[model samples]
Target: MSYAEINGLSLYFEGHGSGPGEPLVLLHGGFGAGETFAPVLPALAEQRRVVLVDLQGHGRTADIDRPLRPELMADDIAGLIKHLGLGRADVMGYSLGADVALRTAIQHPELVHRLVVVSTPARRDGWFPEVVAAMDRMSAEAAEPMKQAPVHELYAQLAPRPQDWPVLVGKIAELKKQDYDWTSEVATLTAPTMLVFADADAVRPAHAVEFYALLGGGEHDAGWDGSDRPAARLAILPGATHYDILHSPLLARMVVPFLDAPA
Candidate 1:
């Protein structure tokens, strides 16, 4: 466990595996923390140094009282990288984390060597307004019950794992009010990229397709293959939902090669 003061916020993070390999940073989604990558860590750590971060208003960090946007979150990651004296590293972002990765690669190109975005749309404008609206409604509905119910009950309702209910609920409650718009900022990325999609995911695959089109270029395939060309690439995991892909070995196989490619 470690914390870094970056841009007026103390960001919580952790690292695993030994050095002498390329560094890989992992960012989680909204209402999640660095531990969201727990399932994927052992494999990734075998050959790469894995850095995991909990974005502001989540995990062990104190909220910096700023609006949540991709740029700001990206800056937090960039600052942590610089502060830790790391060279350019590969970045793996999921959902809200993916948005941060997109923004980081675009705005702080020198900080990231490669990029992977999963379960998140390419363009902010492409996200379903209905999903966002539903999220708002769910949050509103959760408020009163949340006040009266034990945090564990909420976790039993949401997470597959049951040990860290208080932390999860607290993070969810805090980040619920956050919002961001990234439509204009995504085109600036120059890193080699991969956009992974879960076909059964509620998030639109078209968003990932359009995003891959924007970030250099990549192929969109509904099948799973580890090989992709230089510019950019896309792959869809058939029958995998957003949460399902997190634990999928197929997703790991598809992703590792792209980030491990010769630079």
Candidate 2:
């Protein structure tokens, strides 16, 4: 575990693999921290340096004493990357982490070489509000055993894994104290990027398509074209729901190659 102080917040992270290769930073979703990427990092480490960060209010990272928002969280990440001296690297984020990833790229483009966002929603629509509302309900009911669902079992229709339950529930609580708005930040992104989603995830596949269109359509489309345009790319994974896909191998299948591919 490593720690960095950025924007008055104590950020915690785990770094693995050793290489001269460009680094890959993994960011976890809401109700999750860096630990969510534990299962998949080993495979990725074979080819590149891998680092996972626990965002503020999650994991070992210290929660803020004041109100928090995604934009503020994004700034925290940008400061951390610069503080670490990693001028550019591949960055991948899931769910809420994807929101931070998007904002970080837009706010600090030179610091990010490639951007990969999983289960991310389009910023134009009211998708972020829908997501936050669901999170609100889940967090409020987290302590109720009768209402508490098995973290993995809850998303079994998408994938099967039983890791990091307590951490997820804690993160939900942390989110309740946050005040991020993801919709307004999308249009600002200008990094070479990819948006990966699951067909069954809470963030619908259609939003992924709309996100690609927002980046620009045709060969310039970030959705289908793996070409020169890097601001964004979109891939929809079948048989995945919001939370479960974080642990699923399918995410790695799309992400590993994308990260390893030449930029």
Candidate 3:
């Protein structure tokens, strides 16, 4: 376990597994921390060094005065990497974390060798209307009700001050209200990327194809000799959805090989 002073916040990270292979950084979704990947962490760490980081205001990392923004959170990740002396590492993030990974690759290209963006899209509108509506309903009022839910229970058990849950909820709701579009920036990213989503995820299937095409994928079929394949890949796992797909066993099967592949 370690805490690095990054971008004015004490970033919390824990290193899992030890080996001589490439390092992999795992970033979790909103309302979650590193332990959110608990189901797959050991399996992944078996293949490479997995660094789990809790984004600002989550897990052991205390919330700051500023609201959450992808660009700012991406900076925090880059600073932590430099602090840990991992010049370049494979980055994988789920949902909210995926947005941060995309921004990291966009703003600090040199810090990331490969990126795995799971359950995320290039634009805010890519999310289905139902998902957007649910997010819109998130507010301080729901914080009390959420305490009976697993995410809040996890926070209550782990947060520095469990009583701050309402404040966190209000801040997250405010952050989600902001609009963003990263399509042009995503096209310019130099690092290879993999887009992974569940067959029944919050994002529509068309948007996944759209995201991949921006990274030079899904435009055409590789020749029989395999000469025209794009560096990036896209996977939509069957029998999975936005909420539980992160822990699905298939997630490892789809993600690990890409991380292990040559650039």
Highest TM-score among the candidates is held by which one? 3
Give lDDT: candidate 1, residue 17. Answer: 93
- The predicted structure with the larger lDDT, 1 or 2, is 1
Evaluate all candidate structures by whole-model CA lDDT and list the values in order: 0.73, 0.68, 0.90
lDDT, candidate 3, at 125 = 85
- Write down the TM-score of every candidate: 0.80, 0.77, 0.98
lDDT of 1 at 55: 81
Residue 234 of model 1, lDDT score: 79
List clashing residue pairs in candidate 1: 218-232
lDDT of 2 by residue, 1-263 (tens): 77898878778877888665578888887645676787788876777778888776565665655444556787887887887788887788887788778777877788888888887665534255576676557653454462255434433322212233444455556655455445445666666678887777776556667676666533454345544555455677777777678667777787777776665
Would you list the clashing residue pairs of candidate 2?
Answer: 192-230, 193-230, 222-233
Report the lDDT tens digits of candidate 1 across residue range 161-256: 344444444445444445655545556667888888888775776776666667645545434664454467778888788866788777888888
lDDT per residue as tens, model 3, 1-263? 98899889989999989776678889999889999999888878997789999998898888988889889999999998899999998899999999999999999999999999999989988999888888888788988888888899788877887888998889889888788899999999899899999999999898889999999997898989988999999999999999998778999888878887876
Give me the runs in candidate 2 sitting further than 4 Å from their true place.
Answer: 124-185, 217-231
Estimate the lDDT of model 2: 0.68
- For every model shown, the clashing-pair count is 1, 3, 0
